[model samples]
Target: MHGPVSTAWSLVALCAATGAYCLLRMRSGVEEQRRAAGGEALMGFGMAVMAVPAAVYAPPRWAWPVYAAVFGAAALRALWSARAGAHHLHHAVGAAAMVYMSVAMAAAPTAHHAHGAPGVPPVTGALLVYFMGYVLLSGARLVPAAVPAAGTGSGGARARWGDRPELARACRLSMGIGMVAMLLAM
Candidate 1:
C-alpha cells in the first residue's frame, strides 16, 4: 500500500508475521484448517510484499500485473473450494481484493503514495466496508462460547498452538485489519 515509509514497513512486519503464523497453522490436525491456512499464508506474504515501501525498493512495473495474476488464480481456487464450504467464499473475496489493489497500484504506481490524489475510489470504499465488517465479525467469533463448564473439571487441555481455532480466527482478524489499512492507503 502507498503510504509513509514507517507505515509501509509496519504493514510489512504485520503481514509477514501473519503469514508465518499461517504457515505454522498448516500443521493443524484438522484438514479444513490446514487447507485454509495454506491460502491465508499466501495472502499474508503477498500483502507483505505489496506493502513494501516504494521509496526504499520500488518493484518493476511488471510486478503489479504478476500480483494481479497470482491473486486472480487464488480467487479462482477459493471459489472452487467454496462449493464445498462457505469459509472459502471469504477467501475468494480476499483474493479478489488483492487483485483490485494490484491493478490500482499498476495504474499509478507512484501517484497513489503522493499527497494529491483525488477522492477514494468507489470500489475501494466497498472493499474497506467489507473488510471492516469481517474484522468485527471475526473478533466477535473469537470469544469463547457460553456453554456451562462441565463439572468444573479441567475441561480439556487447550489445543496446541498450531491447532488452535481461536488463533486462526485472530489471524483472520489481523489480516482483515491489514486489508482495511491497505485499502485506506490506496
Candidate 2:
C-alpha cells in the first residue's frame, strides 16, 4: 500500500485494538461500561472496513447494497433506542453516514468509484466534512480533565470526563483524525 493507505490502515488497526481492549475491560465493569465497550468495538470494526484501501478491496457492487441495508438496520435500532441517551443519537448518525457512503459508492461511475478519488460528488465531500467535525468534537468531549483532589468523594476516586474509558476516548480521537485524513485524501 502507498503512504496514505498505509497510514489509514495503521489508524484502523489502532482503533480496532482500542476497541478490543475496551471489550476486555468490560468483563469487570458496570452495565454502562459494558455497553460503551460494545459500542466502541462496533464503531472501530465498522470504521476499519470503511477506511480500508480501495486498491486492496473496494466493495463489490452488490456489497454496497448490503452495506446500506446493514447500516440502515443499525439506524433503525438506534432510533428505537433513542431513550437510552445522546450516544444513541450519535449511533444513529453514524449508521446514516455509513448508509449514505454506501449509496454514494454504488451510484458513482465505475471510473470514479475508487475511494478518495477526485471524481467524488460534492455531497460526499460535504458529508465528509460534516463527519470530520462531528467525530473530532465528540472525541474531544470524551477527554478527561484534571480535577482537584479535594473534589473526590470519600472513595477518593478521580472523576472521569464521561462514562467511556480513557483508551476508548483516545481511540475516538484517533478515529476522528483518521477520518479527517481520509476526507482530505478524497
Best by lDDT: 1
Cα RMSD of all models vs. native, in order, equals 2.9, 4.4
lDDT score, candidate 1, position 80? 97
Q: lDDT tens string, model 2, 1-186?
A: 123777867867876776566567566447766765666566666667766777788777798798788888888877877787877776677677668767766775663555674565686577677778877686767755765466566587744534435655676566556555555554
Q: In terms of TM-score, which candidate is strongest?
A: 1
Badly placed stretches (over 4 Å) of model 2 are: 1-3, 25-28, 109-126, 139-144, 150-154, 157-164
Extract clashing residue pairs from model 2: none
Against the hidden reference, what TM-scores do the models get?
Answer: 0.89, 0.71
Q: Report model 2's TM-score to 2 decimal places.
A: 0.71
How far residue 63's Cα lies from its native spot in candidate 2, in Å, is 2.2
